[model samples]
Structures are given as C-alpha cells and as structure tokens.
Target: MLLTAPDETQVIAREPWIPRRAAVCLLICFCLTWFYTLGARTLVPSDEGRYAEIAREMAATGDFLTPHLNGIKYFGKPPLQAWATALVFSVFGLGEWQARLWTGLCGLAGIAMVYLAGSRLYGKGTGVTAALVLGSSFFWAGAAHVASYDMGLSAMLTCALCAMLIAQRPAASPRARRNWMLGYWAAMALAVLTKGLAGVVLPGMVLVLYTLVSRDWRTWRRLHIAPGLALFLAIAAPWFVLVSLANPEFPAFFFIREHVGRFTSDVHSREAPWHYFLPLLIVGITPWFGVLAQSLRHGVRVRAAGFDPGRFLVVWAVAIFVFFSLSNAKLPAYILPMFPALALLVARYLDSASPRATIVAAAPVALLGAAALVVLWFAPAWIDNAPASTPVRRGQVYWITGAAVLLALGGAAAAWLARRARTWALTVLAAAGFLAGQALMLGHESLGRDKAGVAYLAAIRSEITPQTPIYAVGQYEYALPFYLGRTLTMVHRAEDAMLLDLERRPHLWIARLDTFVATWEAQRARGIKAIAFVRPDIHADLQRRGVPMRVIGQDARRVIVTNDVTAQRP
Candidate 1:
C-alpha cells in the first residue's frame, strides 16, 4: 500500500486498509477512554450526587412530573436529565454507573453526530478527526461521564445544529429535508427539556445570527415553521404543562426565576469575571489548543463559494461563547455546546494543515503538558491546598505522580510526532493525555473520600432501621441521602439544597434550630433511634449545649452522630 499525499481528502481511497485500521483503532480508543472509567470514582457532591439522588428519588417515588431532592421538590432545572437517569435507574438499579449511563451515552452520541456532520461538511478524514477532537477534549470527556444535565444539553444542541445543517443542504431531497427538519425540531424540544429556555433560545439565536450574517433569509422558509413548531411544542410543552399544572408555582420559578433571573442577575451567586469561560475553553480544549485556535481563525474567513459550513460553524461557536460570556452567571460547562462546532472547524483545519503549521501548533501543548508535569512531580507540595491537618498518604501521592508522568510522556510523544509530521499523532497524544488526566481526576477522589461519605454510609448502613429518623442538621453532604438510601430531614436550614421547594413543602424541613433541638431531645427521651449529619462546628456547638449524642463517624467536614446510644465503631 503506497502512502497518498495529504490533500483535501486526507484519506487514501485507493488503499482502504488505512481507513479501516484507523477506524478500528479509533473505536477501541473511544471505548477505553470514555466508557471504561464511568464508575471509577465515588459520585462527587454538589452536582453529581445531587443529580444522581434526584433520579434515585424520582425512581423510588414514581413522580416523574415533579423532581425531588431529599424528598423535597427540586426545580433548579428541568426534568430531562433526571428523567433519563430515572429511566436508567429503573433498568440497571441504582449505582454510580447506572446514574451516569445516560450522560455517558449522550456524550458518545454527540461525538457520532459531529463525525457525521463533519463528513457531510468536509471529508471522511475530517469527520474522523472531528470525532477524535471532541471525544478526547478534556472538558467534553469530563462532562461526558458526570451525572449532569449539561452533557444532555450539549448532545441535544449538537443534534439540532447538525440536523439543521443537513436540512439546509442544497442537494438533499424534499423527504430527506423534511425528516432532517423534524430531527432539528425534536432535538430543540429535547434541549429545552434538558436545560431551560436556553435550549430553544441558544439555537434560535445561533440560527438567527447565522441567517443575518449569511443573508440567507430564504433559509427561514425552509424551516416549515407550522409543523416544525407543532412538533417542538408537542415534545417540549406537555411536560411543562403537566409540571406547571401539578405545581402551580413551577411556572414562575422555572421560567422567570431560573431563566430570566439566573441570566440577568447574580441570583445563584455563581458570579465570574466577564472572561470566565475564556480560560475554561482554553483549558477544556487541552493539548489541541493551538489547532482549535487556528480552526476558529480559519473558520471565520468568509468563503467565496459553496455552502460555507465553516461560516455557520463559526456563528454557532462564537454566538454561544458570547451569549454565556455576557450572562451574569457562568460556569465551565456552560460553553460545552460550542465544542462540537469547534471540533468540526478544527478537523477541517487539520485536514488541510501543512507540516510546519502542525508542528507549530503542537509545540504549545507539549510545553503546557510539560509544565503541568513539573508542577505535579517536582512541586507536588504546590498542589497540596487541602488543610495542613489533613493526612496525606504516600501511596496516593505516588499514584498521582505516576499519572502526571504518563501525561508528560504523552506530551513528549505528541511533540515528537508533530516534528515528524504525523497528522494522527494529535489524536494519539490527546487520547493519552485525556486518559491520564481522567486517572488523575479519579485519583483525586481520595481527597474527597470523607466528604463523599461512601465509607461513612457503609458503616452506618446496618444501624439504620426502616423507620430510623435521619436529620441533616445545619449541613448537607449531597451524597449522604443517596448513600443512605433515604431522604434526610433538613434541620433548621433550607437554602441551597431545598430552595423554593422548601416554601412549597416545608414539612420535610424543620425551619427553626430551637424546634429541632427540642424535638431531638424528646425523641432521645422516648428512646427513639435517630441519626444526624452535622458540620464539625455545629457538632461542637451542640456538644457545648449538652446535646446528648454519640459520635459514630467523623470526617474533616462532617460529624455523624446518633441520639444517646452506645456507638459501635463505624
């Protein structure tokens, strides 16, 4: 088999063996990198545990319309993510992988969508490269396995964008066009369910901006607005109507408060500088930073002829990037939707890039990875931001150090490949770095072991009777309720975890500390078995107030106590 010149196609059509081998390798790498590590770590709190528990509670209670957290109504976001997780739980039974199955699957689907989109817009080689970039990108892969709504949102948004692009193809048949348009509508509706109004708003904004720039006013006529809208409303509206009807306050809370207020004000206190996502995007793209930047730069150039998918991709990436940048609240994952478009653009750039240009681009990633390796191996002390009193284990430290070494070698190999003008080296290096980075992240789970409370919950599992009363007093470890297999009585505080749900269903929460103390004392006097999870500070205060409790488990952040009993080692 003779090597063909690297051209627009990049693939050697005369010798099909090359592409078949490449495809086989890509599939194997995808499986190992994406799916194998889904259950490597305990679910981390705030988001992972919260979403997983919501799904668990939804499955346990059989209330799909109203999302619940710790037995209270939770409306922070829409039900799509929870609904999907619940469905997974129903099938697989509750566990870490089961909770994350939907998200991981969606992430894989998003990669496939980008591959198809890139193949249609560019060539087979470009399509394969696009899939590699997306599946290997650190941020995308990180969000892919986490039990969060953002992955779902990103997948649906990609579907809508890719479907719209297919629908608008000049050579497509009428029936094909209609089906693609329907896909676009269905994806948009699912996106709305996954997140909030941003599902519809972000895609609509992107399309409108693309039309304005491309001067494709006729494209609007191709949407078939009547039936398209009907399809959208049919898929997206029934849930809103049912949820709102079931909980009247949901309308104001979900739309006005969650959507309008969250965007316009600092309601969630997730304030960040205007350029918050800039660094995140940089770090998220990881070793491919140079390629991604060049792609965006090349993508924005006005095409003289043809369909100009690059221009549309540019609009998609830039519009979404700017939209969240201008919003009052921002998070790292907020810009995930832009990545698929960016990957396609980068694939196009790589497909046509010169050897010198490729080397120049790969240099920075090598340097960056080298710097990170130095920080991890030589300056391990710099990474220890945890409390000085916290015990550091030599074994775990060495494990992290090993992961860093793997990353450094990956960087070095990538640089070597770049110098040799190996186009596929970027994918290989990225896969190595991402796989190592994931291991590093998974290893960090040791740091949060106490906070995650998986071990603590195991110790207390037998102590908890069917009717044992549990209280989260003055603190909440998001993983506790899920691990304990029961909802906690939120004692004396109903803020972040409870939110507006507290107002609607305050019975699940004791709003006054004094009332909670009195009830606890009475329960103790009556010889009722009860357990409470409280912060260390709160535990000391309770101890000072002569709260009769025996410590059953202790950690850096929390102390689990039982009301007046001979606490066995747990």
Candidate 2:
C-alpha cells in the first residue's frame, strides 16, 4: 500500500507488504510457535495444577466466591485468569492441555495485537518485525504453555499501552479516544482481574512517566478520565467488590498481602537486587536481545539529531525498567509487559534504518537459532540426571550459556557487517524467532522429562488395575492428580499415608528414590503382588536385607517390583 502524510506531506514510513502477507506471516508464526504447546503436557510444575485445581473447584463446588489452592482458600490473585481457565475446563475438562487453552489463545491474540499496534504506530515491516521478536521471547513461549497469569498480564498491558498511544496522537479524534480509551480500561480491568492491581498500577505509572518525559502533560486531557474511570470500575470494581463481600479477607489478601506486601517484602520468592531485571530483559527478549540493544542505541542516535524517536523509544523502555526495578518484588516474567515498547522502538528504528543495520541484526538471530538446535540435540542427555554434580547436566547448562554467548557474538557481527543501517532491525527479529522456534520444537523433552508427572500418571492409568493406589514420595508433583483426573493424598512420610493407602487398597504404586528399600519387606509381609517405582535403589537394599523384590517390568529409567506372594498378610 502507498501512503502520504496529512495534506499530502512526505510519506514518513512504509510497509513493504500488502495487508494479506502481513496477516499470513503473523498467523503462521502464531500457529507454529504455540500449536505444539497446546498439545504438549503441562511443562510447568505447580502453576498448571494449582490453576487447574482452582478451576476444577470452581466448577465442582459451584461457588466462585473464593479462590482455592490445593483445596484451601487461595487469595493470591484475582479471579479473572482463574475464571477464564475455569471456562476452558468447563468445556474441555480439567487437564493441563485443556486448562492452558486460554494462555495459548491469549498469546496468539497478543502477537496479532502487537502487529496491529506497531503497524499503526510505525509501518507494516516494523510492526511485523516487532511482533516477530516479541513472539519468540523466552517468556512468551513458556507462558503460552504454563497456564499462568503472566501471559494474560502481558496481553492486557500491551492493549492498554497501544490504546493509550492511539489516544495520544495529535490528530486523534474523539472517536479514536473513545475507542482506544475503552480498550485501555477494558484491558486494564481484565488485567486487574487476572493478576491484581499491578495491571493498573504498572501501566498507569508508565503512562504518567511517558507524559512527564514527553513534555505532554496536557495529553492526560484526552484520557477521558470520566469515561475511563467508569469503565475501569465497571469492569474491575464489580469483581473486586463482589469477591470482597463474599470473603471479607479478600481485601487484605488480594490488595495488601499480595500487592503492597509483595512489593515491599520478598513475600513469595524474595529475589536478588535491582540488577534482577537485567537478565530478565535479556532472557525475556531472547534471540532478539542483541537486536533490541542495537535498536535502542540506533534509535537514540537518530533522535539526538532532533528527531522524536529517541525520546519516545528510550523513555518508554527505560521507564518500564525503572518502574519494575523500584518495586521490591521481581520476577523475570514480570518484565514481559515492557516488551511491546521495545518492539515498537525496534520497529521505529528499522523504519528509519539503513540496510546495513538490518543485516547485522539478522545474523545474531540466525546464530541464536542454530544454537537452539544444538541445545535440542543435547537436551535429552541434559535431562538424564540432576544438575548437582553430573558433568553432562553441567554441560547442558553450558550449552544454554554457550548459545547465549554465540547469540551475542552474532549481534556484534551484524553490527560490524551492516554498520549503521536500518536493515539490521529486520534481520535480527526473524533470526530470533527461528532460534526460539527451534527450542520449542526440539527442547520440549528437556523441560520436564525425568520427573514427567503427566507420563507417570498416564502409566498409572494404563498399567494399574482395579483401584490401584498411587503414592508420590520424595516430593508431591501436583500435576499428577490433574492429569490422572483424581484427588491425590500426599505422603508426608514414607511410612505415612502411602503405606496405609497401599494396605487399604491392592497393587499400590509408590514413587520415591530414598525409601524404596523399606517397601519390599512391607510388600512381602502384606503379600503385596508388585512394587512399581522409578528407581531400583529400594530393590537393591531390600535384596541385601534378604527380601527379594524382583523387578518384573522396567523402562529406561524406572523399575517395577512384584512379590510372588498373593493376598493380605496373615
């Protein structure tokens, strides 16, 4: 498409592709990246189970008044995300694949929205490039599959910022303000529902900072404060008010303990110093990390020559970083919302960029992609053992570190090759996407293979017959019950409920590395027919104790033990 500025002025920016190609690339990117995740077993540990459990409770109890964690009242977050997960579970049933549906869907929506927002703000190519980079981000992919609150938060925040950007345009009409303002409030309110006040707090702060830095305090006038406030309260307030009324402690738990308390103190997982967000931005940006730096520096150089690009890009980017840094609570994922700004900035830099800069950016991304292939090829070996002391597992981490190092080197090479050209921005984003995709395709096995709760539960369903008892020792993998479609009791001690549960029922499956030996005597004494486990340490020790726990069936990793004696202990 061709375009001219207002009054037939110079065409400041152009997108090379027609609308059709842009949409297709984005759609293809979206489908390929997360299409795998939707089908994959829940890669996350507790988050999937915790959220899925809450949804199950919501559907089962029919009382959405309070959030429940492990069957207890859990007020850690607002109900928006839980409600969405519940809707999916309601339709699809409570499995990780079904429960995580919203995350993947929202992730794709966010990718599309990025292109829309970027294309409008800059040009088509820049918009596509921004989406490409952000889509492949480390957090983006994981968040899509993890069934967590972060991805929704990212979507909400992006929509809010993009809406606000449209609202701030000089030539913005009342219609634009109303449309975008409504979107802003709606997204903010949903964000509030998803994760809590930070949805409103962070973006609000960023906008205020942007206004201050942009020397456009007057911009707030079009914010349409009256309607904005009404919309936010209308969307967000009802849930808060209702939930608070239903549970009086909701106010303290949701607002104070979670938001205020979490920020001032290390409430959940007290992380490191202000430097916490540094690696996060790096990892969260991934493959594109090098490209973004170039974008920032190049964008800055262009603006220093009396252009507004630096002010807009730098202030927006730094403001987000500073906002999170000042907050005491920090997680790598918390910085996700800041990416759209980086994307937009990168797009702008590329739009005005020389061809050389574009090529340099692509080289690093290509290198990062190739590096991910290396990780995938070796990820199986890496997942074989604990990272405690094994040389192979240690080398696996080295692989990740090495991939990262090469990615950086490639960026330097791109900068050297392209010099100060705009094409650098174009090259890097595609490369980042390619590498990120490689990891997604080949590295899925490496994530939770050794302790794969889904596979374990599946085996229990298929192999064990007639109310077989399943006990997870050493640690409770919460995902077990969700995948198994059962309520699992925890074995506080080896001799605790697991022993008793097995006694009450026949053919029990116990999973523990430390106390497998003791189970053999108990198995024989009780006339237990079989012992099923992931290791043979227990079998070895039991044999040494003169108790024969023969392994009937064994896989590459685990062994199954069965005593020849049948019936209960007499």
Candidate 3:
C-alpha cells in the first residue's frame, strides 16, 4: 500500500534510499544498544526506583492484586506495568536490567508497530524510516530504557493508534478491519491498565478531534463499538473491580484524586505554564525537530479521497499535545504518547521532501549540537558553587562533550550526503542521535550513583542485619530500599496519602523528631541495634540533641548511622 497522495507514492517508489541489508544491520545494532544498556546505569529516583521497588515487593509478597511501595499501599497508578515487571522478577532475579526489561520490550514493540503501521499506510521505505526515527528519537529511546509507566502506556497507545489507522484504511478487507479494530480496542484496554484514565481519555479525545477535523463522521461506524467495548471491558475492568473491592479506598483515590485532581489542579506540585511542553517537544525530537515541523505543515495541507490516515495522525498528535498542554500538571514524559504519530508523519514528509529540504533539516541539528557544546563549555564556571563534586562534574562534561561532537559531526555528514546518498545520510544521523542519547543516559550514572544510594550499599549492608530496623528520618531515599531489598521505617509523615494511615499505623510512623529520638533511645536501652538514614541537617540536629549514634556512611545528601557504636565506620 502507498500513501493516498499520488506524488508522495511516486517519490517513495523512485527513491528507496537505504539498502535492505544495511537497514537490517542498523536495526540489529539498535536492538543490541537498547537491551545491553539496560543494566549500564543505576535506577534513578522518583519514577525508576519507585516502579522497580513496587514490582520487587509485588513479586516477593505474591500480592499482584494491589501494588505497594516501601511496604505501603500505593494506588498512584495502575498495576499493569508493575504486574509485568513483577512477573519478570519472578522468573529472573531482581537487578537493574531485569527491572527495566518490560519497559525496554515495550519500547522495542512500539518501534516494530510503528514500522508496520508506517509500511502499510505509506510505503516500505517510510515504515523503515519511521522505525529508525522512533528507535533513535531521544525521549522515546531514553524513556524505554528506564523502568516507568510512560513507555508502557505510550507503547499501548501507539498500538491502538496504529491498529485503528490500519483498520480504517480504504484497502482493508472487512474481516481484516474487524480483527484490527478488536486489536485497537484491546490495546486501549491495556493502555488504560498501564497508566490510568488518560490511556482511554487521550485516545478517545483524539478520535473526537480527528472526526471533527476530518469531517469523517462515518469513521465511527467502522469502529465495531459494541464488540470493541465488550472486549475493552473484559480486559480492563477486572483489575479495577477486584482492586476496588479489595481496598475500599481505591476508587476515589485512583479515579478522582489521581486522574481528575492531577489534571485539573496542581495538587501534585507538578504544575507548569501552558507553553511548558513546547521547549520539551523541540528538544525531545532532537535532530528530527526540523523534519517534525515540516511533517506537521505538510500533513495539514495534504488531502486524500477516502479515509485520510495522514489527517487522522496529525489530529492524534495535535490533540494529545494540546490536551496535556492545557493540563495543570506537566511532565516531560506526559506527552510521549504523541511521538509515534509524529514519527509516521515525519517519515511521510521525508519520503516526499527534496534533497535540499533534507539538507536544510540537517543544519539545525548541527547548530543545536554546536550550541550544546558551547553551553557545556561554560556550564561548569556558571555553577562553580554547585554541590556536585568536581570529578562528577568533569565526568558529566566529558560524556556530554562526546555526545555533542557526535551530533555535530553526524549532522554535518548527513547534510553532505543528503543529495548523493539519502539512505546513508538518514542512517548516519539516526546512529549519532541514538548513540548520543545513550551517552547522555550512561553519563548520568555518575550522578545517579549518589541519588541511588549505591555508594552506601556496602556500608548499609555491613552495619545492618536482615531484621535490623532501618528508619528514614526527615528524608526518604527512594532507591535505597530497592537496592537493599528491604523497606525503611518512614519516620516522617509521607506526603503521599498511600504511604501510611497515621490513625491505623500509628506505631509504624514516627511523626516528630522528638518521637524518633525517644524511640531510638528505647531501642538502644533494649540493646537493640537500629540504623537510620538522616539528612545532613537532621543529623546535625540529632547530634546537638545528644543522640547516641555512630556514623557509618556519609554523603552530601544523607548520613547513614547506627545505634551500635561498635559498628565499623565507612
């Protein structure tokens, strides 16, 4: 199948840029880089550590119905990803790569789906290009390597979007269309299970917008809504129903607070201005930002006779972008679901674009790379007083410098080759972008080590026994629990409602500094050994209060201490 536009189809047929063998080699290399790098870095905090720990706990306790983090009931998001990760952990022992395997596979699947969809909708060349574009796109590639809900959610949403497009194509047989529509519905169900309502809401919104924009009201007739809805509910409803039944508080918290409150208000303290995603979208697209701009512009103007897949794809990208932009809560990954559509659009645009346009597209990437180099050169001086150690800062600079150089040289080479060898030009740029992104990610391990508390792991293990009570005072190290394979006693009241119920789990929480001190004293009096991870300022305060503790490990962010003075210091 070819693009609906005759001219675009001709361009694709005339210029099959890259050789088939080379494309296969590039993809094989990508898969190696993608999977091999999963264990290359420590899991960073907030999302990576949180999700991995939840899955670890789930696997350990054999509680798949409800998710828990740090041994506390957590309903912040759905459990599909956690369930998958937990299953992985159950089969393979817990580790960095094992934790990220599910997300990585989802990311790989998204690339394959984009390739298939682009191939069917546009042409074989367009499909191959789209896969390269998505597999190397900085944000898409980076998010896949991290253990998070966004990749899983985005992958399913991409599946739904691609299935719908394929199903609604003018050339699809009735049986083929029905099967694809059912797949679309099932993908949406899995998407809803991956995140929350946005999984369903985003796609539903895109459908409405696409129908309105294309004036293709008849599109709804082909959706097989009755059977599709039945399939969707059959797949998505069981977990929500069972979990809500098991935990009475699940309904309001998961539906109302997490979905509605997170979107409509700044309750999560993640609010950003309306134009927040604009810069992210630009940078996240990386070397392809120029192509994206061209794609959107061309996609809007292109018209087709029957069902317009390009128009639908454009609407899908725009609706999702606008939906999240208007939201009170903003995150870099929140807009990820729109990327696959953008990839298809960009692939279509590249298929028809002149060599001169391709060269023009390569210019901005080169310029951005140069600009990044300049920023990195002066960044150290600008942040001379920053808390990070000089060696850490130097290492980060080196890694970024390598990435910038790759971008700069690759972009220039792609521009030089665009007219003579379009296929090679695309391959060079994609390889650079992919490697640069991996470099940036691997470089972060320098800083992620501290954030992940990996440096203190040996000290922590040596000082504490399996049954030793570990308390988190004033601050919680999200990644440490996952590393240590144990949960910490949260001394402070957790900000998340799911952390603990103060009324019911009063014994589990030490609400005040004084209370923690008293508890420490009582434990010491009973000849019990206890370990606590305390913030530096909190540690100083405890020292002033005459608390008896031996410092076992120390870092700028945290101080690990034990009540047993005989414990060896690190």
Candidate 4:
C-alpha cells in the first residue's frame, strides 16, 4: 500500500484533522496532569531547592528588593521569579505546590501563546498541534513542574516571539500590529527581569539573522520601535536603577562578571563541550525527533512572496542554539527557548505530512519504548549486588515499567491509526509522550528524597527553637533551609560565601575549619544552643577530634548534630 505525497497547495487547504470537542477534552486532561503533579515529588537540589529557598527567604524577611539564599545576599540573577514565587507564598502559604505555582503558570502561558501564534500564522489545526507538542515535550514539561528560572524565562521569550509573529502578519490591521508589537516589547522586558540580558539579546540576534536570511527589511517598519523601546525601558529599568542605588557593587558583578565572565570564561566551573546540548536537545523532544527532522527540512524552502515566517522560525531556533553552544558555561536548560519555536515548526510539518511519513515518525517511538522495557527487565539483577542501589532501584521500577508500557502501546496505536485518522494518531503520541515524562519525573522522588533531607526534618525540628543557631559545616543542604523555615550560617564553604559583602559582615562567613571549631567551643561554653549539619566524613573527623557534639539524626549525605547532649535522640 504505497502512498504518494499530495499536492502541497491542496494539503494546505484541507480541513482540520481534530474535532473541536476532542481538542477541548485533551486540553483539560493535560492541564489536570500538569498541575496535579506539581507537588507529587520533593523539590530537588541545585535549581529546584535553590530557587524555592530564595522565594521562601524573600517572603519571610519582607525584603523583596534584595534576594538572599541561606542568609547571604544573592545577586546571581534578577529577582522577577523570586518576587512572583514569594507573592504566591504570601497568599497561599508555604509548601511545594505553592513554591512551584508561578513556574507552572508560566509554562501554561507559553503553551497558550504558542497556540494563538500557530493558529494565526498557519491555521487552527497547526495552532492546536503546536500547543500539544510544546505541552508534551519532555524537557518543557519537566522544567515547568520544577521551581526554576528557566521556565519563566522561556515563557516570556515565547510571548515575545508569538507577539512579534502576530504583529508582523500580512493581514494584521494597523491597530492590531501596534498593540501586539507593544506586547512583544513588554514580554522582552519581563524576560530580562526573569533571567538577564539573554532575554533581549537572543531575540535581537534572531531578528538580525531573520532579516539577513529572509531579506525582509520592510518588516522593521511594523515594529513601532519608539513606543516599543519606551515600554521595554519602562518595565526593565526601574529594578536595575533601584537595586544599583542600594548596592553599589551590583552593577559590576551582575553586568560584567555574572553575564560576560560567565559566557567568556569558566569562572562558574560549569564549562562543557560545544556539543553538550546536542544530546539534551535530542532527548528533550523524545517521540517528536522524526517530526523535528521533517520540519527543519521543510523550513528551508522559502515562500515566493511576503514575510517568510518559516525562515524566521528556522533562524530563531538555529541562532539561539548556536549562541548557547558557543558559550563557555552551559546547562541543559540554557536552550529551553528553542523548544517553542521547534514546536511551531513541527506542527506545520505534521499538518501537511502524508500518512506514510506519520507512520515513519511513530517507528522510533515504538523502538525506544521496546528498548526501555528491555533495560528495566535486567535492572534488578544489575543493581542487586549494590546495597545502596536496592531501595532506590526497587522504588523506581514500577514507574519506569508503567512509562515504557504507555510509550509502547501509544506508538503502536498511533501507527495503526495514521492511515485513516491522522489527528487521533498525533494526539495519542503527544499524550503518551507527556504521561511518560511525568512518570519519570515522579519516580525521581525516590532519589530526590535523599538529597532533599526532608526525612530528617522531624528529628531536627524537635530539638531546636526559633532562636537556636544552625550552622552548615563543610557542606550545605540546599533543601533543608526551606523545610526548616530558616537559614543556616555558612562554615568553610567559600564558594557561596564569596558572593556576600564580607568587608562589612565578616562574621557571617567562616573561612577556616579551625575557626568553626573555636566558635563551636565558645558557643557551648556560653550555654548557647547550637546545631550543625555536617557531611558524614567531616562529622566523623570532628568526632575523632573530641568536638563536643551529639548526633540527633543521620543520613548518607549529612549528619545533624547538637552541642547539648540532652537534645540527642536515643
């Protein structure tokens, strides 16, 4: 049953593949899964715990102007996300879901913007498919559920991208163009506040690339630059002005060292190879890899006339990819802004693709699913000999098994329906991709629990009062401060302590282990209650040195100890 490609013109005019009611139902289900899973797992460290704690501190201290983590001033990024999350905490009360609410909303907003842009740029079908694709994308979905700066930044950039597309369309009225262009500028400002200059820089780079590639110089006339720049400055300037007035050192550190130094040098110790994001991008779009290849190929063919949006989107995605790839410091989520553009491109390709092409796309998904099942089958035997792996592996097996089954069955079903029911086939694949991503994230709680230190909260809380002094000696548990509703004093952790203004507040930072030991001895002599969270190896060394401490709780990562023997649990 060989099938030939249909005429491109005819395919463009065909009716939408999905019915209206079904689209609505699918959207409802997606929303349920998205928000329902926000609190299903503990907040993981590095990004999740860091951002959440910043918000928690902001709310607790009522100092929204300057962000702080573990009681020291933190100026690594702008305060927009922390401000939003702190507001959520003020109204909703503190919890995992409350901390993550803002990020979830940002993710939802990005999907909505994509749907609107896709519908207007291509058609209703393309718009719907684009939203589905973005909402289900493994990286986008996972990042959205976690408390972080990336999703908020990505969502604002998506708004800017969509607003520009809407404003520049050939059929747009003068008033509509003016309004949407303002929206584009405002989104860019929020994006700057969300992360930094990359918000505006990345988009500005795309515009330059798009103009050069598409030769659409006249498109600039529709941007309403005077008012757009005014709006942008109005929104993004005040914070910089206020923060700089309060802290003289902010301008240099934020602009010069944080942004420029980070990109040009490896000061942050996060340097990676140029190809670091390649694997991330590949896995980021899971089942959609086949469609992505098709879309990029389709995007290269220029239309004969007016605004070449396809070319613009291609440049938008490629330029951002190249920009970050060249940077000295790289993280997985640095390329998140590219996902929305890729979704739009993939949506356009799927709209006009033949059934045979759709079936081909399903093949990889099915194969990947089978491979996952095979790995899961032997996982137990492989980890059986390792004592530490047993609990975590056993807890995760059910989730991995369920995800593999969903992907396997969904791919097969989509392939079976492609010949006669194109919409249903794509919808099934998107749903499976979404659910599988959620399952994997939920399963990560097994490991996240250990890192988060939430299990030790009970014992630690029972021993301490609000006035008790807590010190993180030789290590910092990123998640513990938020759970405890207080910050820990830094001891011998120079990397984070270096960010503070040590000239005025030298006591806040402990630069040497001997200094920490002396302080502990003095506090114990004064009969002042103090607690310390120390790494296991450091705890053993301190114990061997005859430091007066009693263990209240112990975990593989850290040991919670107190100076008073009565506080220790039997």
lDDT, candidate 1, 93-148, per-residue tens? 98888888889999998999998887765667677778878887878888987888
Candidate 3 wrongly placed segments (more than 4 Å): 1-11, 374-388, 499-503, 568-570
The clash numbers for all candidates, in the given order, read: 0, 18, 0, 0
Candidate 3's error at 441, in angstroms? 0.7
Worst 10 residues of 3 by lDDT: 1-10
Which candidate, 1 or 3, would have the higher TM-score against the true structure?
3
202-251 per-residue lDDT for model 2 (tens digits): 77777676667656666667677888889989998887788778767568
* Per-residue C-alpha lDDT of model 4 across residues 1-570, encoded as one tens digit per residue: 322322212226655667779778877888888999998889888778888999999998999888888777788889999999999999998888988888999999999999998888778788888987898889999889999899999999999988998888776789999999999999999999999998899889999899988789998888899999999999999999999999888898899988999899998888999999999998898778877877887866635246766778888889989999999999899999999999988888888667877787677888889899999898888778766758888889889888898888888888898887888888998898899999999989989988888888998898789999999888777898888898888788744424556545778778788988999889988989899999899899998999999888787889989998655455
User: Candidates 1 and 3: which is better by lDDT?
Assistant: 3
Alpha carbon lDDT of each predicted model: 0.79, 0.62, 0.87, 0.86
Badly placed stretches (over 4 Å) of model 4 are 1-11, 15-17, 302-304, 494-498
- In model 1, the Cα lDDT at residue 293 comes to 68
Q: What value does the lDDT take at residue 310 in candidate 2?
A: 40
RMSD of 2: 7.6
Task: Kindly provide the TM-score of model 1 when superposed on the true structure, using C-alpha atoms.
Answer: 0.93
**TM-score list, all predictions:** 0.93, 0.74, 0.96, 0.96
